[model samples]
Target: MNETKLHDLIEKMTLEEKAAQMSQVVSSFIHKGSSDEKITGPFAGMEVANEDMTGSGSVLGATGADNLRTIQKAYLERSRLGIPLLFMADVIHGYKTVFPVPLALGCTWDPKAVEESAAIAAKESAAAGLHVTFSPMVDLVRDPRWGRVMESTGEDPYLNGVLARALVRGYQGDDLKNDQSKLAACVKHFAAYGAPEGGRDYNTVDMSRRQLMEYYLPAYEAALDEGAELVMTAFNTVEGIPATSNKWLMRDLLRKEMGFDGVLISDWGAVQEAIPHGVAADNRDAALKAVTAGLDIEMMTPCYVQHLKTLVEENVISEALLDEAVLRILKLKNKLGLFENPYRGADTELEETVMLSETHRKAARETAAKSCVLLKNEGVLPLRKSQNVALIGPFAESTDLMGPWSIFGEEKDVVSVRTGMTEKLDTEPAVEKGCDIEAVLPEQLEAAVEAAKQAEVVVLALGEHSEMSGEAGSRTNIKLPDAQLQLVAEVKKLGKPLVTVLFNGRPLDLHGVVDESNAVLEAWYPGTEAGHAVADLLFGDTNPSGKLTMSFPHNVGQVPVYYNSFNTGRPKDQIDPEDRFASKYLDAPNGPLFPFGFGLSYTTFTYSSLALSSEVMEENGTIRVSVNVQNTGAVAGEETVQMYVRDLVGEVVRPVKELKGFSKIHLEPGETKQVVFEVDEESLKYHHSDLTYTCDAGEFIVSVGPDSRNTEEGRFSYSPAGRSGQE
Candidate 1:
């Protein structure tokens, strides 16, 4: 469809017909091998709409490939328009070849791996006639309790931007129109949906404009900057207004301010829910408000079909707005080649060719390997090959390993840590379940103790079930669930050195485990070959080189704990160093259990003096800060070189410090490399009340490190060095 033809089609649509295209329905199809339907949806609220007018069709992800095709054909054939309706699904990590969910993927801090995983997901999703994926959710999440946090790129704006751009490019590629291996990338919750109050799902977020722009909106901006065709509005309200109907956020910030020339979609039935948000009186009002606010599509919000016509007749929404939104949908159809080739993605041969290919699994494996973060290691790893080891816990061998939002993932295909350990171990370690996390038994305790006692070291594998975290999985206490702590205490009582392998989706408060265990690995639900990746890390086939993208709080009460908090007037110590007046916690550290940008490698590294190219920078000058990073350990390793900068003197009080840049580097034993980060006014940029970004002429300190606690510091001054580029 060219411009003229697409315009003609839009002009021909009835108000009802046009509204029909706005929202999508979630339908379940009978599986090839099973009669029971798969229960998948948000709160399972889906209309029983058995009709489909678009030909690309419906999806049955749980039904397997064969049945998904059958259902798609049914939906396509049932359509009178022959317009080929697109099958949109959540292909977050992999279609069949599952990889770690987005949060874990961010930990790998590997953009290439993220891109590769998206490509693999695209291949499998396209095979299933999935024209678009509501994925690569680039929401920048600092709080972990939001179950959907497992689905987002972690807290760092820089990292989220990098990964978001990569995922979009990977999913759609350079030319999406003809790329059969591609599926459209839908960057979701267009504004700041990630900073849900208290990290609870669907909670209201009343954020300041500066905080929203600085911390939360970067990834959405990055995705749009990468040409993402669709942007999904969040379910929560921004400030006091529902995001789906906030014209300022939808039109001004996302469109005019950010220059996003794409379709805007609601997250599920968010448009109609605006009524409940106290922003609208009824569905008709909600529909009109959403469209006027630039919501191009309603997603699963059926209120569009029910009320858009009346709103249009009443002049509640202008025809021009309707045409604009409808055309955005048509434009995507044109790009997808859906107008001329409605079934472009629905090929039987291609479907058979692409689902979970060996190539795809290899990507999943590599992604899984990269996401494994070694939180603690006391050289109890690598299994000491010939020694006896105990792999105890429900998750050790039991396969339900897919992380959060694994709507279409297959459990049988997941690589179990038990399998990986057995294959890597020279001797078969005894595998036993500690008392089930959900169920404790007296007999189970005896079994757990027996396994731990018989082994030289116990690898205690434990974590929340897939349902315990991510979307609707919010809990006030994000401690290890199922009383797994009880099991951990029992196993530790065996007097054996213990290593813990955790697989929860969000950040967990593991004070007891951290205190008692000799080693800990935070493997946030590594996808398909998760077991193999854990095995690789445990046995040193691959040393875990991942980092904490989100800070780990010692307790959930320290909600929203981050690395860059501002100091009170009390300061670190003022007037009384030993008194409670100077920022001392009455009962807490006033910090995180593990700070952000913290990670360990099998081998240790040493940092040298910071060398700056200049002490003072002019408007056009660039300062290069370099440090020598020497791999001091006996084995090859990798380390993330973190750079943090502080505004020593600011008109307004500043944070303690902020992360400016980082680089992941690999080194062999004894090899030393000079790491340099280029700094300019850009590193010092901040938003002013005038709503513009500017860097002041003042002194700035830069620190390079493995963690924020430890750093190699240097000083520089910027004078009349105003920035002239985008922030």
Candidate 2:
């Protein structure tokens, strides 16, 4: 259908029908034989009538081609205009063939691998009859206490933005209109959802506009620039007003300023939440504000269905606004090719062959291995298969490898750590669940110690339960449960080589485990192929190349520690160590336990021979910065050479270091390669106090190294249009 046809369809809709088109409901409401009495679950109190169900424009939480075909068939028969219903789901990460969580995916530092993982997710989701996936969650999160940080990529705007574009391109592809296996990517938690106060879920967010633009808003803009078709509003507020109803945020910024003409939908129940936020009088007022602010669909809410028509009739809201929202929804359906084929990509035969197939599982395993970061290693890793090994923890045989937001993933199909290790070793490794996630029995701890004593090496597989992190899984103390910590302490007394493999969603405060273990592996919820991937890393099959996207604090007290922090007037490093007035912690270091881009491999790498094409960079021109990176160890490996920049002076205070570019390369033993980066003028631009994005003509420093903390720096001067000499 074309533009004229979509408008004609809107012209034919009744006021009630038009209002219903802007409302979304759970799958149960529209399923065949579902009645008001049968509606039990999250939607039980929704009070949805049968008429409302028949007219709803979209359905969420529905899966499987057969089930969706039945619901769509029944829905179209009851529709007066026969407009097809859109199917959306929380396909963050993957569908049936699950991959690592988004946080884990970010650690890979390989955009091509990340893109492939998303493509596999889209293929599986499309086969299951999903049209849109609320994914590529590009929120820039600095605080790991927020449970939803697992869904975001990481803290740096440049890295998050780069990954966001990769996800969008993978999901939507180049031709969403033509490819049936492609899903329309919905980049979510719209305006700064990650900076919730105290890192609590649905908490208020307060920040200046400059802060928002510099750190929080860039990733969303990057996703939109990649042609993401949909945007979901964050549950929290941008300033004092809720994001769903903040007109300046939604209309002035997202729609006009950011140039996102895509359909804007609310996160689950976010529109009705405006009332609880004290910004709206009631649901009726919430509907009025949300629609006028450019929100197209209200997910899991009846505010638009129950009151939109009345509000339009009373002249409180314009009818044109309703038409625009309805038309945008209709346009997406048509773009999805739903009008020509209402059951687009829905085939029961295809679902069976494509969902969790061996090919998709292989991709998942490879990507999962790439995402496992080696935080600490002391020659205990790359374990010998001949040695007697004991794998003990809550996750040794547990199949809860897929982390949160995996609504359709099954635990039965997951690969356990023991199973993966068993396939590699000549002798079977002893495995024991030493304790539950939070509680341990005395017998269980004793058994774990005996198992450790009998083996030459101990592999402690421990972490938070799947529910402990992701969407409402916030924690005040971001450490391993005391039960597991106790298990580690007891096992460490056995005087055997110990390797701690963590299965978590967030960066943890690894005080107890890191100190006791000989090696620590951050194996964050490695999805369906978790066992195989970890087994590969445990042995010498694959080297650990994954780096940290978020910083791990020394303790929970240093909650918001990140690499690109602004320096205070009384700098800690510049001042005397005995100076009490310096910005330094008395008991702890002012930095993180492990900085961003920090990882370890079986081999080693070194950087040298830094050079620049010129000491001065002219406007509209570029400077070539090059460095020599070599594999110093005896084994071949891949390394991520990171480049960071700092403005010596700025219109506003600037971060001491900001990541501008990086390159991942492979080298053999003693092999050397020259990694070159073009530092353009655009890379130096930052938001001023007045919000103007431009670079100041002054001195700058360029640093290149393996991680954010240890780097070699060089100085240069940026001269605008006509300036010629160095500062």
Candidate 3:
């Protein structure tokens, strides 16, 4: 339908019907048990009657083709105007065929692979009748204590922004209106939801406007730039105003400045919870503030349905605001072709054929293999099949590899570590149920130790349970559980080669595990193909090229440690060796256990001769930095060459190093390739004291390396014409 027809349809809608368009509810409200089988969150008394739900414009937490078809048939049959209901769900990482969590995907540093993962997710979920997936959560996360960091790409704005666009492209595809296998991407937690105070979920976020724009807002902007169809408001307040009701943020910044004209929706219960945030006196006031503030849809809440029309009638909120909101909602439905065919992708036949299909599983396996990061390898990895290996742990036979947000992924269908190893090895290895994930038993530890003693090498699989890291899954301690650590210590005493393959969601503190194991692989909750992917990396079928997108702190006390932190006035490097007055930690090093962009590979790659094309670059000119990377080892591998830039001086404090460009290249043994990057004026720009983005005339350092900690450096100067000299 075109604008004219959509406008005509809106003209025919009564105020109540228009208000219903602005309200959304769970699948239970429309057809019971659709989402109730695994309802984990609190929603006992939040049910909306079937009569009230028949007119709702959208439904959340509803999936499966048959289930959605039944509900949509019931909904449209009871509708007066016959407007189709939009089916939305949280298809965060994957649908029925789960993929690695977003954090693990970021470690690949291969946006192409990342995009394919989203595409596979889009295909599977769309076939199951989901139109919009609240995914590609582009929040810039620096703190691992915030559990939802698993959903984000990670700490770097440039990296997050790049992956955000990749996910948007994968979900939205080329044409959302015509493609049945694509779903509209909803980039979520608008504004700075990831920087909550104390690394707490839904906690207060206090930061300067410049800090918010400089460090936090880029990923959201990048998602919008990729034509994300929907933007979900964050739960936290931005600059003293809740994101759900901050007009300056939702309207002035998101819509006007960011050039996002898509539908803006509130996170679950966020609009009604504005009362708790002390921004609104009641649900009615919340309705007024949210609508006026430019929120188009209130998810899983009755505030808009019960008070929006009344507020409009009382002139507390403008009718035009309601009209604008409703029009955007209607336009989205029309664009999705919902009016023509309410069951857009709800085909049970296609769902069965596509859900966890063999082809989809293959991609999931390959992508999962790429996502696993090799944190440490002392020549014990790429285990030879001839070696007598013992796969021992809770995850050895357990099928809980699918992490959080995999609502449709079945645990039974997941391949376990033992199952994957059997298929890869000439002889099946002995396996034992090691100590539990969170607790250790005497018998369990004894059995695991006996199994390790008999094998030539120990492949100890351990990590946080599936419930440990996700939404509301924050933890004060980011280390391995005592039980798992004990299991590692016992296995280490066996005097056998040990390989630790972790299955976790967030970056964990590996102080103890790394020391005990000769090899450590951060195989973060590798999805349905978890077993196959881990085997491939273990046996050298695939080289491990994944890098950490988020820094792993040395301890919980260094919670927010990251590579791009700005240097203080009394810099640690310049401080006196014996002086205790510097900005150094007394007990721990002022660095991460694993720095951002840090990862190890089975083979080694050498970086040499960082060269700059020019000593100086004028305004509108480009500078070229080139470096040679060679595979020095006797095996094929992929190398992620990272380029970082440091501004010598700026009006505002600057990070000592910021990732500017990166390239992933495959190399055969003894192969050398020259990787070049062009640094333009855009690369030199920064958020100034006045929040203006411009570059100053100053010297800059360009470094190229395998990771953030170690790099080869070159110096150059960038001078924009008419810009003042360095302060």
Please report the candidate that would top lDDT against the real structure: 2
With a 3 Å backbone cut-off (N, CA, C), the pairs that clash in candidate 1 are 54-85, 55-84, 55-85, 56-84, 147-470, 147-471, 148-471, 416-531, 417-531
- The digit string of per-residue lDDT tens for model 3 on 261-319 reads 88999988888778889999987888889998999998877888888778878878777
| Runs in model 1 lying further than 4 Å from the true structure | 27-82, 573-576, 721-727
Residue-level lDDT of model 1, residues 20-84, one tens digit each, is 66656554421123222334455444432443323212232233344445654565565555455
| TM-score of candidate 1 relative to the true fold | 0.94
Ranking by TM-score: 3, 2, 1
Question: Against the unseen true structure, what C-alpha lDDT does each candidate score?
Answer: 0.78, 0.90, 0.88
RMSD of 1: 3.1
Candidate 2 error regions (>4 Å) = 33-51, 722-727
RMSD of each: 3.1, 2.1, 1.5
Per-candidate TM-scores read: 0.94, 0.98, 0.98
Q: Model 3 RMSD to the real structure?
A: 1.5
Clash list (residue pairs), candidate 3: none
lDDT of 2 by residue, 1-727 (tens): 8899889989999889988888888777777553221111254444454335557899887888888888889999888889999998888989999999999999999999999999999999898888999998999999999988899999999999999999998999988778999999998888899999999998999999999999998999999999999999998988799999999999999999999888999988888888889999988999999999999999887899889999989999889999999988988998999999989998889989998899999999999999999998889989998989999999999999999988788999999999999998888998888999999999999889888888989999999888999988899999999999999999988789999999999999999999999999999999999999999999979989999999999998998999999999999999989889999889999999999999999999999988889898887878899999999998889999999999988878999999999999999999999999989988899998888887888889999999999898888899987654232
By summed lDDT, which 10 consecutive residues of candidate 1 come out lowest?
53-62
